[model samples]
Target: MDKANADFTPIFDGQTLAGWHAVPRLPVSRAPGGPEPDRTTETYRRAAQTTGSWTVEDGALTGRQDPPGCGYGGYLLSDGVYGDFELLFEACPDWPADTGILVRASALGSQGYQILLDHRRSGNIGGIYGNGIGGFHGINFTIDAEYDEQGRPIGLRLEDPATTIEPMTPDKTALLNDAASGEQFLSIWRWNEWNEFQIRVEGALPKITVHINGVKMTEIDTAAMKHPSYRQDEVLALLGPQGHIAFEVHDNDPGMGDARWGPNAACRWRNIRIREL
Candidate 1:
């Protein structure tokens, strides 16, 4: 596999996390009456638990909830902020792990646009989400798990068959384009295996594009985006033109039988390189 090549520079040293820091991550929203609970107190408590463990294993950067099955998660953030760049990385997440790559993230790490790597029931991958700006889901499909006889996840399936491509609607067409169909995505995706991901983000209200295993996933023009809770001006002010790149481990759901991260599960990432635009 060709790396970033001559035009890009490597960010991760492969031996150590020299330019990164860990921070507690939480779900947040900027919309009124949008489940934006007062988690400030909870956040303080969580920060004390752990920056959930981030370590280098087998040459890959791995992240997991400390002590596993714990309700909280964390983020590994780049020390420097970035703007208008293309990033390339490979990911291999354990089944049911809720993970993501964050772009233009705030110092705290949760406020940004996330490219979902939520490998679990009713989750979507290769989609854009408003991490803390509004919780907007810029996606058209959700992936679920297929189980073996003992109920261990053996493979994946689309939650809704119709979402295989999700027929283009006027509203969706206006916000995004060049999307890969669920069929197209599944055809190339290797279950329980490493997959390459490419993300390009540019401008303040950027146009975000994602490719998975060389398949064009989707493109979102934030400049023309329309969502009830997402205000371009407000998000721009909050995130600014530059922010840190972050790797996320989502908080475990407290509800009965709804685990976001599989017990002892971790997400592995490597070959992280970037090119400034």
Candidate 2:
């Protein structure tokens, strides 16, 4: 049974890569400027040149890539699995970079649910993305805002309208279009600065909610809908009970050899904490 208690604990020590593992990664088909897959965990650890990189600096957990855009970005997997819990962290991404948090994420190449971290004009931040299954299953739920240390709004972060090319239901696609024009979301996003990120997931596919700066951005109820593939339930089942939490450095051919891994590919995270409810 799931508990309702809230006792958060630190996971990363901020000094080492303990309790984390790097999964082997390579570029997807037809992507250029990306390296080949390392083939094994050991091989990934031993390679002089890493397609993706992870490090601890200034007490922050950082994941980085090079040459931006070209292929698939790398992933860092947790040593443990979690379900029906809340996660808190700070993420700062360089514009043009791609990143996200994977829940019940599988090491088998994007097989899980993702919380988008792309803050670009064509990206969806604080949105639902289907890993290995495809792209966004739902439209973005939060608006971007820029604030200062004093908790005052400085400005708003906005993404330009993007053409929909992913396989999505007509209704959902329309929803995305409407959302892009709606000022329903508030932006608290800051460039090259730390931003608070929180996620509350509970009740199996019961309820998943995402927040930025304590603002509710997106929510999903698994029982209310199903993926068209007829495997979303099965996949969620595989994730539930318990599954790994992960961070992704995305690498894909956005267009014309533009790498998902951009020049400022160093995405930093810190103050990791989690607790089961």
Candidate 3:
């Protein structure tokens, strides 16, 4: 919102991406005589089979999702890792779906912070995903679902407590209470409409500030998170270098869950940008 700091520079001039490299999508191996194919393999195949589903149009980079295999997304990453930076972007999900902007990813999993764009009326919008303080940091919110032995949802946990004031699990895995504390941090926007998202990261101190539609929603202190893989110095060293920025299009095939109105339902995106601070 303020003038670019001395260490910051624009990565997208509102049209084409600058100071960033396009990590062209690559393909994964497929098994012989497999049933249909796994989602990851299909996703990588789509990326390799054609130019990415993303395109620069009308001063914005757009991501389009096609049916069949829910792959082909958008991403513009810095050539190097940045310990501190501010990322800004505007996105609009297709009539009935959601998407996410993932930062500090390890090319293995959603490790750092994810700005969620949920469209369902169920109130899962604008939440944070993956490693963060207080476990699953973001707007305090909860979903009712019963879990199987492996932690998979078997049915809605009707008796589950609200999500606020629930301390994160010791391993930083699950949210514990029923008070709805996490839901208080998000600013919900219109579904199927463009909304602005801002994320600020200070890698050294490992702090995060999230703003949605001009409303400051949550600020997380990573130092306080339950189970960290390393100490402050180690974390800083690992994250100090520039890393990849990615968009997560979770597997939403029909059998995975009720596909109606879920991420597999539909989704679109445009106008993505990031600046290194």
TM-score of each: 0.90, 0.74, 0.59
User: In candidate 1, what residue range of length 10 has the lowest lDDT sum?
Assistant: 164-173
After TM-score superposition, the amount by which residue 194's alpha carbon in candidate 3 deviates from its true location, in angstroms, is 2.4
lDDT tens per residue, model 3, 146-263: 4579964443222234442233333332321221234343234543467777878775545677777777655655565443332444444444444556654443333323322343
What's model 2's TM-score?
Answer: 0.74
RMSD of 1: 3.3
Q: For this target, which candidate reaches the highest lDDT against the unseen true structure?
A: 1
lDDT of 2 by residue, 1-277 (tens): 1222347777888999999987745432111122445556543343324446788989998887643332445788889888778998889876556688888776543566777886543456676666654333566432333568996445555533354233224544332212322244443555568888888777655466777766666776555545454254555655555667888776655362333455655788898888877
User: Model 2, residue 89: displacement in angstroms?
Assistant: 0.4
A best-first ranking of the candidates according to their lDDT comes to 1, 2, 3
Give one digit per residue, the lDDT tens place, for model 1 in 21-48: 9988755666423566565677557755
Clash total of candidate 3: 22
Candidate 1 residue spans exceeding 4 A from truth: 1-4, 31-44, 161-174, 256-258
Per model, how many backbone clashes are there?
Answer: 0, 18, 22
State which candidate, 2 or 3, has the greater TM-score. Answer: 2
Which segments of model 2 are wrong by more than 4 Å?
1-6, 26-51, 66-72, 134-136, 141-157, 160-170, 173-186, 254-256
Error of 1 at 206 (Å): 0.6
